[model samples]
Target: MPFRKFLGWFKGFFGKKKIIRLGLYGPPNAGKTTLANKISMDWTGEPVGKVSEVPHETREVQKKEKVTVKVGGKTIVMNLLDMPGISTKIDFEEFLQYGFSAEDAKQRAKEATKGVIEAIKWLENVDTALVIMDSTRDPYTQVNITIIGNLEARNIPIIIVANKIDLPESNTKWIEEAFPQHPVINVSGLTGSNVNDLYSAIAKYSK
Candidate 1:
């Protein structure tokens, strides 16, 4: 293993009070950053990254360290990792709809591709993963399957987040049915609905 990866493993395995490396992972525009920002701002008084209508707006992993969350007299200190949105493919043409120039579109596609690789690599470093899914969209996608498979293969704890429950078309039940084995929390990161339930889940399940 690389020195950095080894160090991460060492700390997670042996450190006292082990600051859980909580990773936020999901498909593009699935509200990963929005939830991350909500968590960070609630605990650290800071936001993780910018929210955007554009896919891959968070083209890099954002970290907030030493965030202390307390629930029911129990406290969990963690390093929150806000990961880039994962996608099966990146097409430059997709950016054109957002009014991007040809050159910028291609550049964004390249960066998004790289971001996917980086997010996958960071999987090895995460202790717990929150798989955020857009409650308004179908949950049975290759991207979601791939992410869950990778995390499960590594024996990492998984919490399925049914985000955007505030939307009229949102069907959090569909997501719960899709991944019944994992714990699912319905939340609307944008409106902060049921977010307390998310925090309680994080406190309960994060390792």
Candidate 2:
């Protein structure tokens, strides 16, 4: 390789690319934490937050710092912010199905509402956002549209993750049609399918 090209590549490898806060935002049970865990584990040998079947399992914004990701021979440093699920309404009755007492459920509901606010406030600090959507669910919901609109209005770099592609009913194409202007990577966070594609997209577009 030529010396100049080598130097450029070396700079890309070692030179300071300002670290970015890459946030994950989506509705409840859309695999935000699952994807965060996958990426964090791959790079840092750790998971950012626990995953649960119950909705609003992650009732807080969880952050993992200094995670370095390499894609297509280029590396980028990021602080992964796994934001809590965004919902317009939170009712304690929803938690009853999870076997929580009425009091416990109410408390959880309160925290979850707070989490939604924190997630939105954290958006001001995020340089890029991964709008995660469940591929198996309809992508035209108010929550999904609202999040994307907020990010677009701010001109934030956005990548739509059509997660859970491993499921039989997962339809990534629907997401493409929903938001034709943005790039979407289809993957299964639970099974690790096509996650490398997501990494490459992050490297290519998030910069």
Candidate 3:
């Protein structure tokens, strides 16, 4: 069957809505872009955004459409927005490793500061947010808490994605325990693990 038809059938089987919106948000290098790429590929069969090892690779919000997902026996069309990661401080050290001269690094550092501010400003416009976090790192960063607190203050639904679950040092349980009130899902973007559950959770609350 055609992929769209298959998606439609799948959606019909699940009883999901016809349209949904999701915003992917997280700190730098926490797999926000990775998860976004995975979801875009799974639903549309193509990548909608760029993936990079460097922090702040996505400086702007990249959106991809034609996402056909099944929830509660119905097909729902999703418009996924992949946003730039947030950080309290710019990483000039990593920027220098990208082969940029000291002058260029300094310039980019300033640009990164603007980018972080832009990302925080953009959060207010999103309907729902998926806060991605690296499972191997501590989730106690100020940026993480600020994003969560702002989202909660605005009453926007949120899903905390603990990515890189396949990594040996991943500690998703700790994240869940730390943010007991927020919904948390363990996933591996590289291996496409536990993605369906994440999608399902987002779909459930979004509707």
lDDT to native, each model: 0.92, 0.92, 0.83
Q: Which candidate model has the greater TM-score, 1 or 3?
A: 1
lDDT of 2 by residue, 1-207 (tens): 979447656776996466778999999999999999999999999999999998999999999999999889988899999999999999999999999999999999999999999998887778889999999999999999999999999888899999999899999999999999999999989999999999998888774
The true-structure Cα RMSD of candidate 1 reads 3.4
Model 2 misses residue 169 by how many Å?
0.7
The digit string of per-residue lDDT tens for model 3 on 118-156 reads 778877877778999999999988888999999999888
Per-candidate clash tally: 0, 0, 11
Summarize candidate 1's per-residue lDDT along 3-65 as a digit string, tens digits: 955776788678546688999999999999999999998898999899999999999899999
TM-score of 2: 0.92
Report the Cα lDDT for candidate 2.
0.92
Model 1 regions lying over 4 Å from their true place = 1-15
The residue-level lDDT of candidate 2 at 26 comes to 98
Q: Mark the regions of model 3 whose C-alpha exceeds 4 Å error after superposition.
A: 1-18, 91-93
Instruction: Work out the TM-score per prediction.
Output: 0.92, 0.92, 0.86
